[model samples]
Target: MDYEAGTYQKLPIKQYPARELGETAEGRYWRRFLSPATAKQAGAVNYLEFCPVRPYNLAVTSSTRVLVYDGATRSLHRTINRFKDKAYSASWRADGKLLVAGGQDGIVQLFDVGSRSLLRQFKAHKRPVHVARFDPGRMHVLSGGDDATVRWWDVSEGKQVSRWEGHSDYVRAAAVNPAAHGTWATGGYDHVCKVWDARSAQSVLSVDHGAPIEAVAFFPSGSVLVTAGGTQVRVWDLFGGGRELACLSNHQKTVTCVTVSPNAGPDSSAAPRLLTGALDGHLKASVREGVYELERFQVTHIQKYPGPILSLGLSGDAGLLAVGLADGTLTVRKHAKPRADPAKAGILVGRRSRRAPALTAATYRYFIRGQSSKAAAKDSVIAAERKAALATHDKFLRKFRYRDALDAALSTRRAEVVASVVEELAARGGLSSALSSRDAAGLGPLLDHMRRNINDPRHAPQLAALAHRLLDVYGGSEALTGMLPALTLLLERVELELRAQDGLTRVQGMLGPLLAASVGAC
Candidate 1:
């Protein structure tokens, strides 16, 4: 377990895999997970949150762009071109289509899903709106900021309707309880988690944490409130008549934010999930037992990573996790395996002692059959399938032994797999039914592979069909690529098409590809 501060041990989790836990199991895992790698020197990741929508959820990156990825398919749909600023906080409305985000600039803007237009702009707070959340109760929107006030915005008229200025310092986080409609809560550097009756803008309850509370939220039932920061997560039991229920300590650095599992609704048996993002560079999810009892063998499960995760959001099915780090990196991580058998893994039993992996083959065998259950085995099967596809792709290059390492890794089958991944991504937006999503605005990585096919008019008929389809979705015609040939042809085709046409004006610019490495003597 040789883990140290500021470094994450990329543990070998044969997650699906008795398969590809990592291409190099210990240091790297998926190729794309490391594609948008962080700089050696990282930045301060301010916030991380997720939309409550289904498969594809929106996450905010430091580049100020909002990235959407599908939890089920493990692919991304590029919308980095949509939000053109440094976003502080982003959230989806209860219905999932309308998205609202704010930043240090002190203005909060709402985008309508159907029109993609700014429906309204309201100045809810003056000192840079830090966070804004829509009340699931359909009452009002709650927002907090450096101004030290939590304001309630009237959703119908687009104006500030009420405000509660209580804390002496800046507000860092906020949450709304769905069960307790017309109610919400806030956490701040003031070292307090305050519950407010959203209907009245009045502070109803306040709990003091020993450190600044970086994140806060009420559990699904509104009976308990959880807040975390400085390596501890404190749960307030309002159900216990305002008693402190439990405190969890595992994070190596300051805990950034904690989100409950989307599927942990009233009737679910799976434990309540508490995901913690850390300034120490990792994100881990721990389930709550409600009564402070650990299960059979080793109850706590953790996944380590190599970035300062500032934010985390759970997909609607709780099947996927989106982690946003300070490095301007957005990673869509698969959720950890289900709880391990406590009776199988020897219990520490009331003591925080070391946890050991079974040593004997008999022990390993006992653990393996269970540890690598149908789910774990399922991961292996997926990895094997992907590996075989990759091998088939490289077969031609290896027989001739060209030695061009790049060609050895990038193969035709791999390219086709990328297309399938893209289609899966576009399917989330219901884009797979048409040619538009399959061609552009599909999976970002998959789209990269298709760019080489742009010139073939033989590919042209499909490209034209795809372009025309995209025009129908986007309602305009502009080449996603900057090349003169493509742009010229796209414009002319748009005019000639008897049916409607739509397209991108140009491919969106990348954040840092053109920049030289930094020299650090300042």
Candidate 2:
């Protein structure tokens, strides 16, 4: 009967603890920065803007100079140092041929990007001009100043088009709506953000951001607005009477700038992502693709910088990320290309060609070149004769060696494996034989394992029975006197577990009537 195979109760699988975190596809995508390119400036970097066309040359504003950098190589392409005072916002036109920027001299200057020559200059503000941007039509430019006023300028005419004086404090940030031809937004030190239309004399919409507004931007659709101030970044619904949508407060200091990815529009396949820079020297990216809920507004990725970040810009194709720091340093990181798997890539000999010959099917060359790795077909039939290798204890159990099987399982130092072996031995009426061992060294490990797992409800019944059998077999054995201490400890543990179970049973009995009454009321 011992040699005959008997049923072994299936036990829950034990999971091994992982030593490291698993990286997800999205995590790898955002963490693709290679070695960064650094450049020293004469003063704190104030703004960074990327060209709207191919190559996407970056315009970096620092001191009185606006330096243009090659987008691909991140090398200095040209520098425009015509400003009499510190330059502020430097923006690019849609054609990429024209650039505009404001300065502390209270003047807005337009320049030819290729010639690095000033084309037009508009001096209308009484105080320092801090914010300037091109309108969507490319025919107009907007400028805001420390005098608490926003002004519109005609690029070709070289004159002020319209001026709006509404904010009670300095206007520091502005954004042109890409969807609406005349709609734009501005934020300032008075904690107010207002949206305006070029055709209207007054602002079309307004909202209180609850803190000094540092940055304002509109989604591509022009129906949503994003404002960063204090340590919070808030999203608002423009068409819903400026109803608040989501408020993200992940930064520890004042947020300095906020920008939307170029591909984050209604027509693009990628979800809308917001990138924000803060005085805490952190850059955070947040996604707004799922249901609009307060809890869903969470930061997905974070990048740290050495100094407080003042401005951030992503290229038109979202291939380059450039950051301006308060310490007069410019850091540019390019999107790393995904590496192709060497094992799956086809083996092409010599120079690469677009018109390469296709390989034939079912040949040895084709199978060796990654064709065998293709997924199996759903309709294909699978063989059923594959056998799994048995463990050390499993081999002993198959040979009707109960005591040896118990010893092999105990040697594994795994609670689940040991419990399974003991359950199998007891089912075959071999528990007494397996537990009839002599000497302290042989019995100490088994006693320790039982003592540790005796309180676990999953293996309690089997371990409790095994413990009782062990005591009955060795209760009067005088030769094993060295094991008295171990036996005493095991007995004390068993007694503690019994008392705990009794206390729980008594508590359950006392609460039975109360539970019944509550259920009846429900």
Candidate 3:
């Protein structure tokens, strides 16, 4: 669980016998939950939302039903199937007591979340209703539809309160400003995002987004708005003359949905993130920044899906992100935050506590002088000792003293030293004498070294010679029986390599004559 800041642990790129790299903390943190739970819907999912209240239940709209799920456990809680046609959007009232959904039947239905019963139904649009959401006060609900109108309905009376009809095409996205009462925003296929007020009969402000708007959301501060459509996500300042702030083009396909993290606040360490899902099956999060006239937004995190992403939902605490794909796959992933380290925490607190005394040149020089002299002296002594020992070992081998050379090489356990000694002994025809003993102890190390290098084409011949001698000397001893399996496997691998080499040589000989004839013709 120990994580160092600014350090990225890389995952393996290919299969191996070691533990999977995905088992690391950073890997597990960003990994998908269990295999995606398949939603048994007959049609593609259109929208998903998590309740704003405690327990944070989830709602998914697909076909003619709105399915409710336990947010924490990801289990189906209930289903509302009263819609006569496909349902498009599902949203929750601020109090968490009511659930509302717009349907292809051109009607908006409200249900009691606790009782799971239809509480109110109102005919709102003449065509398919694409979106519905509750106002900030929960006293009225707004619904936008394919009829190209955004209408407000008084929830207490279950009657239409007002309607706006500026959009030339389907009205697909809408959101109410929680910080500013009776203020809201809507986006449509007409490629415009309009801010509205209940006190006015006309839109108070409008911004052209350059493409059909599929989804829109207001920053928690109610001072900015984000509109997503086509391949871009644009942020507009609501309070600053309605100027365009930043444009993000991270998605490769149409952005189908967008949501803001509920836990995002002005004092947060980083900007509250805007999560967008696209038709290309990518879900990405981008940090929201302050007013910058021509800044470009960058994606901070991305999660890929198996099908086009149709809906996205973020839990209130920002702990979970739920994605609904067009193929009816519901995947929920937990946010991975960097773990806190006590050492780092202590250092940070200490730095802010009080200033340390500044260093003077005299003290600095005195500290360096004492430490450097001792370190230099120790390093020289160790280096000279190592050089002397190596010289003595080489002298024994040069004298053709096979036992002394082999013993020195074995004690060091250095591959280069052992290989050189074995090669020399084999060339001088002293290999059998070097291994001629039933001591078994010395023979074991030699056999082990040979087994380790036997398959390497460069060392195969020398190792093979040494292995053959050891087998002849100690092949019948009980002590050597335990190592036979390893020795047999090693020899088989070397034989396979030798046969493959011989086959390749034959192939080259046959091709050389044909290549020469073709070259001469050319």
Please write out the lDDT profile of model 2 over residues 387-471, one tens digit for every residue: 5456878878777788888889888988878977887787788878887865677788888888888787776787777767776
Task: For residues 217-236, write the lDDT of model 1, one tens digit per residue.
Answer: 77777887888878877778
Q: Give the alpha-carbon lDDT of every model.
A: 0.59, 0.83, 0.77
User: How many backbone clashes does every candidate have?
Assistant: 14, 0, 0
Q: Lowest summed lDDT over 10 consecutive residues: which window, candidate 1?
A: 513-522
Q: Which segments of candidate 1 are over 4 A away from where they belong?
A: 1-48, 70-85, 262-269, 290-299, 335-522
Q: Give the per-residue Cα lDDT of candidate 3 at 303.
A: 77
Candidate ordering by lDDT (highest first) = 2, 3, 1
Please give the lDDT score at residue 296 for candidate 3: 53
RMSD, each candidate, Å? 25.9, 8.5, 14.9
Give residue 110's lDDT in candidate 3 (0 to 100). 92
For residue 292, what is the lDDT in candidate 3?
53
TM-score of each: 0.53, 0.75, 0.59
lDDT of 3: 0.77
Q: Which candidate is the best by TM-score?
A: 2
